[model samples]
Target chain A: MPNQDEIFTWVHTAVEAGANVAFALSGLLAGIRKQLDVVGICVVMGLAAFGGGTLRDVLLDRRPFFWVDHPGWLWVLIGTAVAAIYLLRTTHYEFTERAIQWPDALGLGLFTASGTQLALAAGTPALPAVLMGVISATFGGILRDVVCNEIPTALRDRRPYAVCAFVGGWVYVFAVRFEVPPATGFLLAAGSATGLRAAAL
Target chain B: MPNQDEIFTWVHTAVEAGANVAFALSGLLAGIRKQLDVVGICVVMGLAAFGGGTLRDVLLDRRPFFWVDHPGWLWVLIGTAVAAIYLLRTTHYEFTERAIQWPDALGLGLFTASGTQLALAAGTPALPAVLMGVISATFGGILRDVVCNEIPTALRDRRPYAVCAFVGGWVYVFAVRFEVPPATGFLLAAGSATGLRAAAL
Candidate 1:
């Protein structure tokens, strides 16, 4: 197994890069579906990309927040929102509810893994660490839905959204305890969550 | 004037005790109006009481969150929710939307002053400190409204909700700068916000 520090750094960077884009796309789609203005779309997209991490950081007492330090993520969110808007305007493909699920699931898995890892690194207990992971995965979508004046899907959807993240968080925690390689464990955990969400849809 | 240290301590305690009760009552009324289940009422009340402070503490990287230290707040929230429910059942008084505005405004002002003070104590710059004050005042209501599946009144209400908090926050900040007595400053700031909101209503 690689050094834990290295694993932590890698997981953080990977989640930041991959999950931001996935969640941003998900938010953009939701915004478009809600028929929000461009500014509203950007706001929702930013919330989806950064909301969970911001919540996690606040709970864990991490300073400056993830997006505050990484202004690049904001740029990425804005760019994606703009591109999505342009594509919808110019293209024949209709952005459907199903399209949102794919990116949302992917982002959920990635964020759950990363949040769990960070909490554990900060010496949080196993249960709260797992809860943090779930929060990181689901809170963004909750904020987006709330801002759009809809009941958050995480709270009301019959489909297993938060449940998928919770289970996947436990999977990642167990993988680390068993000394599975970091990259491999990340994939297993994230894949489990993404696959479950996709199947549910 | 009392020492700034004493003033800070007094403001923190005052806001904690008063705002928790006020906001909890507001949440209970909203929950009752929405016809939420008991658990939903508790959850909404807890969010209204702790949401803004949690946001503030998280942003400031304050550890062992306020409620974590004062579990008493949870009991107070539960007690208030239960009492409010009992009162509604036993009394002829109907819970009206207007009934909520009074407590909400009081909590808003107190929270704004305390939040700004804490941020400044932590050495944050002026504008961000003021912004933190506004956040501490308004975010709880935003969370409450969102959970109830309504657009946050702070965001959409034509009446001066957040604006009152913003103005009153600056009032508290300048009061301190001008060496006003702590108790007087507190009352002035809180009253300004509450009065403005009441007038708007």
Candidate 2:
């Protein structure tokens, strides 16, 4: 079996890449809805993609932030943002308010699982680990809404956003405790979160 | 002379205590103006008091956030917030829009100098350290404004808010480089930033 360090590296890289794309799309749609300028769009996109993980790293005392270490991910985020803007501008497919929920839910589920696992790896207890998952999943949207000058939908909307993440994170922790394969545990967590969020919609 | 660790501890504790009180006051006044509920008031006060420092620690990979290490500061922040709310409600002293500027500027100046110094201690180069200072000083207010669903005053107010903090940080850095006492350097930096912001107002 690979060492703990290898496992951490694998988990961090995979989740970060997936969540970055998902959150970037959400941010791009939100920015377009707000009619922000190009620079503003990029700023919001970057924040949405990176803000949650950045907060997690900070709280965990992890250094040399993920984006800073892999500058290529930033390029990927920018490329996705630019392409999204082009598609929206050229096509008749308008980004309806409801369309953002899909990407947001995807990013939320992915980040929730990843953050919970990371906290567990860092030796945090179970409950705080779950809380970490919620923060990682929800904070990016909160920041995005705040930047857009709106009350964070997470706080204002009575929906089950953070609740889905919290339940999914607990599922992962229990699965891991029961000797579930690490990859399978991740899938279970993400799938549960995404399924619940989609159902809520 | 004290060792580097000793110096860091002294600076971190002193600046943290002072900035906490100042920013807590600013946040309390802001919450009262906005008419947030008690829980909302506490959250804003905590964020204003700790947001910038938390950001800096995350960037620098510092562990066990200052407030986490010394929970006493949380009490201080809470006490200040509660008192401010009580005073605003009981006294005829209306919290005019202008009252916020004083505590905000004071917190900005103190946090700017302390953040710059901490970054230097973390071995960050001069320019990035200056930027960190500006971030530490201004981000709390930005977060507060954003949470309140207003455009950040630092971004909106054509006034030289961040600029003042930047200049003050540089002054502190240069003073330390020229063999000034650490305390004196801090004073110089805080005074310069507060004076500049007050003058701009």
How do all models score by TM-score? Answer: 0.59, 0.59
lDDT of 2 at A81: 71
Question: What are the runs in model 2 whose C-alpha is more than 4 Å off?
Answer: A1-51, A54-110, A123-131, A143-151, A158-201, B1-15, B21-47, B57-105, B123-128, B146-151, B155-164, B191-201
- Global lDDT scores for all candidate models: 0.79, 0.79
Which docking band does candidate 2 fall into?
A: incorrect
Candidate 1: tens digits of C-alpha lDDT, residues A61-172: 7779878788887887777778878888899778666665676788888888888888888877666677678879978877888788876666545577777887889899
Kindly give the stretch of ten consecutive residues in candidate 1 chain A with the minimal lDDT sum: A150-159
List the lowest-lDDT window of 10 residues for candidate 2 chain B: B34-43
Candidate 2 residue-wise lDDT, B22-57, digit = tens: 777677767776776554566577677777787777
lDDT of 1 by residue, B22-102 (tens): 787777877777776554576578778888888888788777666655666666776777787788789988766666666
